[model samples]
Target chain A: MKPSSLLAPVLALAPASAMAGSISIDLPRLPVAEYHRPYVAIWIEGAGIQPRTVAVWYDADHRGDPGTKWLSDLRGWWRVAGRNIGTPPSGISGATRAPGHHTIPLPADLKPGAYTLKVEAARETGGRELVSVPFTLPRTGGKGAGNGAGGEIGAVAVTLP
Target chain B: MANFIMFKSLALLVGASALALPMTASAHRQWLLPVATTYSGEDPWASVDAAVSNDLFFPDHFPIQLAQIKVTAPDGTAGAIEHGITARHRSTFDVHLTQPGTWKIGTEGFNVMGSFKVDGVEKRVGRRPGPPPGAMGPGGAPAGTPGGAPGRAPVESVALDAIPANAADLKLTEAISRNEIFVTRGAPTTALFKPSGKGLEFDPLTHPDDLVANEPGKFRFLIDGQPAKGLKLTVIPGGKRYRDAEGGYDVTTDANGVATVKWTGAGMYWMTISATDNKPTTPRATERRMTYTATVEVMAP
Candidate 1:
């Protein structure tokens, strides 16, 4: 049998330090009229497997309208994971973030493999942008950063321990 | 060579449209343009505008009759439209997308038109007062007198048996058309895309709601649930009124009835496919004409 299959169960029981990682995303403040907090989605996409979502910042709760209405504006994430998982995906969906840098914790128990961290952000009456950082799992200490075109997203960095 | 092929296919499209609406001077294409294709949140609603116009998506001609539209929800249950109003240029309605999957809003029409000879004079049998239901009328109210409305004549559709048996030169043509658009509330589902095994239908390889700009969207065309080979599909992006050129392209289906369309940009696209054949389900009709049109939105990647 493959080594990954044998290590999968042990890694599931491992402590957070062994498998935990974090993704820092920067939302650029744009000089545009009628600005709304952008809906952001971060996920990991690997070959030959379903995309695993790490965090989704959206308007989960709003007065008079469900903030989730614009989740599809995150086009890349919607095509991969948003459309499959229903609105306000448990444990992953949260309130929209302001225009600044924020850190999101990665999900534990990700199998050892090559994956791409995708960060997509879309603003109402504005623009949408996606940034991706490719990296390999089970690393000692490494980091990768991707920069967007500055319409919605800014810099995205993924660090693994 | 590519330009020549495109011109030929466009000519064929115009010819098919002329055959479909024989009375119209200009070819009028029908479509259902949704306010948005994808939506979310609780109690989400989708509003759609229905029209048939000379220019794609421009409500310049007339409105589609609201009586013919049918909404099919994700669970295969019947959904009804709210506040259906037919104006002079376009008809509008709202759908409450209560279910969290893909919903189909469309209309299907079937009619027979032909001529017969009586006393050496040829008389048409299927010419109604105005255009057929679900088609563009001559800049007025919706056609077909289903409800008891004044100043409108009832649609005159003669049955095959109603025609005099002794009449000579009996020729009948069957016209079948479908116009559709897809909207998803939260998650996109395929339950509504299942073919009914009749008429011109779509058996999509790529989900209709998942199309992206500059990406190839694969779709299969079926006539009576069989592959419609060598068919021509014309795709025109919306907002033709603002552009200097029409900016449309034509693609032909392969032997498997599949056509891959790489959308040029981000926006809603109006696609149309029309074909004619000798095969007709109606017993007396000798030729069958089929037209399928869809309004799909392509998002930017």
Candidate 2:
């Protein structure tokens, strides 16, 4: 089934309180011998099987669409959310970021529910790592955040503010 | 002058012979199969079909004894596999799945030995198991040097007059295979994916139990405890059906001993790493070659 058709209803039912909130994630630098910008896959895995992809930081060089092939290496998100969606999906995809903190704002009209922010990274000739943060978006809206760490991608956090 | 000319031609041919030869090792493939892919509900049970065959991808026939098999549950509890009915092609054994998670099923400690005879003396090669005392014929090579670890014996033939009188010549080959299957009664745990660090282990940094297709991931290699750099690991999505498919994933561990590969389509992936050394064992074969194999189930997209 197409992910858009499934997300359409949930997006429309989202309340106004969640609109002002943005889910920012911190992507820390690692201390490995070799370093490269990791292709990061950030998505929200809800109570159900389908997930809402927030962003894909990848090699957007687009010279011949070379980087698109390795995007699937983000196995967890690719299988569940990235495959069916458009390659770049315009706003949702962008060039990879250097090691530091980055933020992805939640959809203004997203429905309230429990979700796990799964952040996975993979780099060529480097290690792969995953960090997950569980959170909930109550319709009433307040504050929610979580943090995790990995080998390739260091400290990772998701915050709703 | 004529003899010198003939020797020069022979020397030139010998120097270029390797380039003209297609050398392939006479190697066998190991396989581990779970009766069913996934089991539901409480008290799930699993049984694996294990075999070693000359053909790496097919069970056309079994050519070697299975030797030993063990399964480590998700909780890190390990137990010898209780063998059940055996057939010409495979051996079946039960795996306890009292806890819900991925179970690491494996086989190790099997040696395939080969040897030769010179001057009426049979020299044992492969593994360190020495022949019985007084079993050697008079004037035969003593059962290896009676000192430090056995040294490598050349697999190739040596001149009879060149054979040492006190030490026997032998080459030892070892095999290790690791297979995994996931059982879900509820949530999965990290305990199921921990590495034993015994042989060539692929400690998944991507959580093997929850692998997803199109997901590029890394698995750290531990060969005999330390990081195994330059270890060759081949990842076949459908190892049993390898010949039936197209390109398979293959990589060598970096200096850090980590192999990274991305899953395209989901299926059962068989990853094998093999290594050899010229150094012989303490009491047995002249040289040793070791191999490790793992069967990973990649969940479909």
Top candidate, metric TM-score: 1
Each prediction's DockQ against the real complex = 0.49, 0.02
For model 2, state the Cα shift of residue A66 in Å.
48
Give the C-alpha miss distance for residue B19 in model 1, angstroms: 5.0
| Highest-scoring model, lDDT | 1
lDDT of 2 by residue, B1-301 (tens): 5433333332332222212222233234466766544443334557777664444445554412334456667677874465565555677777656766566666545443555665646664333333332333333333344431246342333433344655444433333334444443233556755566555566667655556576766887776667889977777655434455534667888888888877767776667676666543434444445556666667654
State the displacement of the C-alpha of residue B274, model 2, in Å, after optimal TM-score superposition.
0.8
Q: Highest DockQ: which candidate?
A: 1
For model 2, residues A1-161, the per-residue Cα lDDT tens digits are 21212221111122224346555544555556777788988887887557888888988774755476566567667656665563657678888888776666766655677778788888877756676777676633535555545455544444454
Candidate 2 stretches with Cα past 4 Å from truth are A1-161, B1-28, B35-40, B53-58, B63-67, B80-83, B112-122, B126-165, B168-199, B239-246, B278-281, B284-286
- TM, every model: 0.82, 0.49
Docking class of 2: incorrect
Interface RMSD of each: 1.6, 15.1
